[model samples]
Target: MGHLFSNYYEAVSVILFGIGFTTLLLNRNMIKKIMGFNIMDTAIYLFLAAKGYIFNRKVPIVTGEVPTPEQYINPIPAGLVLTGIVVSVSVTAVMLSLTIRLYRRYHTLDIDEITRLVKEEK
Candidate 1:
């Protein structure tokens, strides 16, 4: 039963990652692409954090009841995920800002259209 649940979680994570990757690759809108990238980052973070979580484990702390970290989930992966989330947010912000600039310069959001216009101008 536990194995089944674990497999399910892994499968779902993989599916999310694949969908996000495909969206990032196929989407033409800059905002959508950014969203897809964020989704991919989130999926990876979730996978990592989930992998660190152990069954029947308490939170990692030095409490009286749980004096040691033997039965607790590891914290390093979660911390890394937090950092990854921050980085992803920063990247998305920069990408969105660039998209806005592109929109302002070209007056269109379509990637192909913008490329054609830039080529024509050149």
Candidate 2:
């Protein structure tokens, strides 16, 4: 049962990664591109958090039980993922702001149309 649950989490993370990649490739809108990047980031964090869960294992830290290294999964990945999420959030904010600015300047969100307009002006 534990093994099945673990595999399911791993599978979901992999699927998330695949979806993010596909969205990034197929979408032309800047907002969609940023969303895809955020989706990939979320998948990475999910993978890390899943890795931190232990089956039938108590939390690490010596109280009365002898600490067994094998019983606990590393928590560093989870911490790193937290930091990654923060950074990704900041990046998304900046990207969206830029997208808004671009939209205001061009009055259209279509990438191909924007490019054409700029080329014609040049």
Candidate 3:
């Protein structure tokens, strides 16, 4: 029980990743695909944050007293996740904008319909 409890965040992250991947693969709507991408991105961020966490450790800030490396939780993963979040938001915005364009031009958000229209055009 304790072992499983300790890894709860990781477990949830894995579940979110699986769900996102499934949605991305199975969904036909462009908006649903974008949502799945966001979900996958959040899962990755959670996994990285969980990996960076340390039991009974302080934040990765140094004080007047000299502190060893292990005195604080590792900061690399957190930093990377922060950057990932920014990039993810930008990507999501772009995807949503493209989806809007597709909807305006194709009159539908369904991937199959859009592809069919494109093929008809050529």
Candidate 4:
């Protein structure tokens, strides 16, 4: 649809989210799964940024005249995106560290294999 094309960022974000979700679901490699999750996070950030942007609008700071609400783009989405980035990075670091430990213990990164080995140990 024309509207879909006009809002290309949202469309692209949706497509990226689908790809990430599919990768997360279909891949068995731990690193690939993490990559997929990062992709999804990126898509969400892009979507939020796109939604926060407005044509012909200034940033929220007022320089000379008192600004009306309509004069500036909303700042909340940008703030949310920033917060999400911080959380995403923290989560990624934790995941990678855990994955490293798993690799060390199992000598493999395949989750199914690790599960099987754990069951065998039990």
Q: Tell me the lDDT of model 2 at 122.
A: 78
Comparing candidate 2 with candidate 3, which one achieves the higher TM-score?
3
Q: Give the true-structure RMSD of model 1.
A: 2.3
Clashing pairs in 3: none
Q: Which ten contiguous residues of candidate 1 have the minimum total lDDT?
A: 60-69
For model 2, the superposed segments whose C-alpha errors exceed 4 Å read: 1-6, 58-73
Give the alpha carbon lDDT tens digit for every residue of 3-114 in model 2. 7675998778888988887877778788788888888889988988888877776565568777778877676776898799899999999989988988999988777778
> The CA-based lDDT of model 4 is what?
0.93
lDDT of 1 at 22: 90
Error of 4 at 99 (Å): 0.2
Query: Which tens-of-lDDT digit does each residue in 1-122 have in candidate 4?
Result: 99999999999999999899888888889999889989999999999999999999998888989789999998999999999999999998998999999999999989889989999998
User: What tens-digit string does per-residue lDDT give for candidate 3 at 33-101?
Assistant: 989989999999999999999999999998899999979999999899999999999999999999999
Global fold similarity of model 3 (TM-score): 0.86
Ranking by lDDT: 3, 4, 1, 2
For model 1, the local distance difference test gives: 0.85
Candidate 3, superposed: residue stretches over 4 Å from native: 1-5
